[model samples]
Target: MADDSDLEKTEPASGRRLEQAREEGQVPQSRELATFILLIVGVTALYVLGRWGGHRLMHMLRTGLSFERAQAFDATGMIIALYDVAMEGLMTVAPLLIALVMATLVAPFVMGGWVFSTNILRFDLSRLNPMQGLGRMFSTHGLAELVKASLKAAVVGGVGTWVVWRERDHLFGLMLQPLEASMDEFASLVLFATLLIISSLALLAAIDVPYQLWEYHRKLRMSKEELRQESKEQEGDPQIKARIRAAQREMSRKRMMAQVPKADVVVTNPTHYAVALKYDPEKSGAPVVVAKGMDIMAQSIRELAKEHGVPILEAPPLARALYANCELDQQIPAALYTVVAEVMAWVFQLNHWIAEGGLPPEQPGSLAVPPGLDPAAGDPEAAR
Candidate 1:
């Protein structure tokens, strides 16, 4: 079943999975691409050097031949002469060497940028097992690679053979020419053959790029079960997430109810809306809503306020406005500050009267609730 499940994986790999694979030093790469680029670099370097190298070699030869017998007899002069000759050779060849090294280094980074991983360094006893090794050698991936390599070799050999045969007449005629002329023609022939070989490799690389991309994705494909597990890992178990959300809502409700007792007064529409306001000179420039809710939550706030001896005033406009516009623990909008101030002043007067055992202060008449501050009052559509 496990092996069958592995075979059943057909879904495209997710971005995260591809990224993980890259981190483990697995990525789509074509050996032919590397070879092709390096061949091109080699051909280019040879052509460039061949033009300049002859003049440089002639200069070196002239310098060597012109050296005085007195300089050769002096040990220090001989050593200096040898050093100059070595430096000249190194400098002449350095660019081609640099080109080859750079081509080799750049090829792998072409697809997946540079990645350094220790995955290949890890010891795996399974790799050492003869049975597993033999199985790997005969695997579909192994067979595909072997077939691809054989095809590349055939293409290269065929192209090289055809180029050599085409140049055979020119090559044979070179023997009839002067020494320097023949050498030049030979160099051109070799360069032309190299270019033809490079052209064949370029064609192979073009095919290999897409094949490598498809094979990388195929190896990283996920099964239905694996897909679900990955999604669960990323999004979290749905049941646990729901419970966490429920707990958060409960905690928020508890915190809101606790604030009702600290509110100077709760303004309500008696049934639908409730807003508990707190004013502290040290903490706020204006009255802040410690708690506000509507419908069932509004009723809960009113009940909690009443149980805690927090004053409740029936103010439909203020309650509606506060519930619509204010957030819990946030200050009411500046437009409503004047209206809220009047209510707070009235509440303080009423409390003072009750504490003194005097007649309760006259109920505040005609509270100046701001026009268009309350959504019920402000929104024409709600009223219609």
Candidate 2:
């Protein structure tokens, strides 16, 4: 069952999955590439500092070996002489050490870039399980690593043998030459051998880099089921999202209905549509639709308005227009401004009459709502 599941992971890993893997400290790495870089830098540092280093080393050796008879007799003098020799050796090698250190720091970025993660630091008991350890040792990745190691050993060994064979004449001749001449020849031979080794490692690194990347991505591939699960995690479950949307809509409707009591007038289709409008001349230039709804919600608006003594005006065309075109708490369309002004005028007069105990003001007649603003006017089925 596990083998079948593994076989089913044919899709490439998504960016989110890759990022999550990186967070867990799982990233492609080629040991050969890092080793190759360090060697290359070390050799370059040696080549550049060789002549100066040789002179310093020779001076240190001569000074240490030819210490005065007086200094050799005194323990303090002997200690100072030893310290000077050690300092000279450290200075001579310092540049090459620094280069290798820098190369070590840079090598990981050659493939995976810098990743600072502490997840891998956490201890796991599974790592200590003998069965799991044996399984990992016999895994396909482990087999590939074994093959690469074998190839590298063969290449390095072959290069060393070839260099020895090629320099055999020089090696034999160095014994007969003057000490100074022999030292130069020895340095040349060492440089040549180092270059040959670097070349071999470069070839191994070039091959290993691509293979490591391929293997890393292969390990992260997603099964169809896994992809679906991941997408759900990222996007949220569809049914839950729909329920959230329904909840948000209900909350918004309740908020709109709360504004009905504050409105100056409720324009209605009497059965189908209702829009509660509010006008504040000092605050706004035109009436704003504070609440609007259809059917059951419209009935709720009417009941709330009646309870608060807000005027209910029957104007089907204006109600439909406001419901379709105007959003809550926004000014009614500019084309309906003249008609809305008339309704607002009626509202003020009706309030005045109710307070003064006089005859009630006449309701607005023939609200001149534009045909384009009325959605029902344009729909043949509604018109019928």
Candidate 3:
């Protein structure tokens, strides 16, 4: 159970986004919306042009026929009329078809900003195994498809019933009209029916948009195990990383200890922490931390300082400050000025006392007897 929780925490969200994009055939909204607008505009323009041309052609045919023999308007004339109508219909649809084709050609670039891949059609025969294919074909998504089909059928059937009922009176009245009046009425009826069908289709498309988006996201969700597997592949095992970090720490400890003997003073937390400091009056205005470490490393630094006879001071605040702020070979910060000055003053005092005849030169804090030694350890009045 604990392992499962750890795995869940490490998963990346990018895989889910990629999967959703794949499942939905996700065209960017800007592109798809543009294409839809163009389609509507193209169809509407073509429809208006076709209606105008057809009306003019019919008007001309009627006028020409009125001047000819009554018997001349026969089956042969009707056949010619049908041919002319078919040619005009083809011309009307040609512009819409051309626009649709152009839209398809530009769809990918507009949708994706740029196309990075086109390898979706690469074939894999492994997907053709009968049992596996059948299983996929009958999966949960396949079941959801049945629901979509039922909803579409219900919407279309309901719209068809409503349209028939609403237009029944108009349809009946058109059938009873005289021939010239009947033709106008029939044209109007056909146009109204086409408009209703297009409107119904548009409504169906709007309803489908949300359902398709949800289905796409559901298909994109990765199982917990899949998430874990992807993370491991990307970042490697944690144990190996920990071991590498430990090796690096060991190497750093060796380098830090080598710099300790060159330090002017070693400050400490008495037992746990050790920080070595160095000062150069000619080069730096303040002391700098040359090395610092805690626990085993602190003990090693203290031992080296003792062997070299370097002064050790137990100042907890100074040691912590140096350890936290200073790096190897850097001058100490301005804020630590007073504390470091006090440590340096004591060292200078001890050196001065040793230089005079009144103090022992070898032992730092011991007194020594001297014959005829000046009280101030130099010219008495001048030292005072």
Q: Note the residue pairs that clash in candidate 1.
A: none
On TM-score, who's better, 1 or 2?
2
How many Å off is the CA of 131 in candidate 3?
4.5
Considering summed lDDT, which 10 consecutive residues are worst modelled in model 3?
366-375
Candidate 3 Cα misplacement greater than 4 A, ranges: 1-43, 46-94, 98-116, 130-137, 140-187, 231-237, 281-283, 324-329, 345-384
Per model, how many backbone clashes are there? 0, 0, 0
lDDT of 3: 0.64
TM-score of each: 0.81, 0.87, 0.59
Q: What tens digits encode model 1's per-residue C-alpha lDDT throughout 1-384?
A: 646876899799998899899889898888888888899898888888885875676567667667877887899988888889878877887898999999989978886566788997899999999998888898877897798789878977887788779888988999999766777888887787778778778888898889888888988999888888899899999998999999999999999888999999999886788899999989988898999887899899999998998889887877888888899888889888777888999889877977887777665566656677667775544432
User: Which of the two candidates, 1 or 3, achieves a greater lDDT against the reference?
Assistant: 1
lDDT by residue for model 2 (1-384), tens: 768877999999999999999999898999999989998898889889877877787788788899677877899889988998999999899999999999999989989987888888888999999999998899998998899889888887888799889889979999999766787888888888888888888888999999999999999999998999999999999999999999999999888888999999999988889899999889988899999888898899999999999999999888888898998889988999898889989999999998897888898888868768888885554432
**lDDT score, candidate 2:** 0.89
Best by lDDT: 2
Off by over 4 Å in 1: 1-3, 51-93, 163-179, 366-368, 377-384
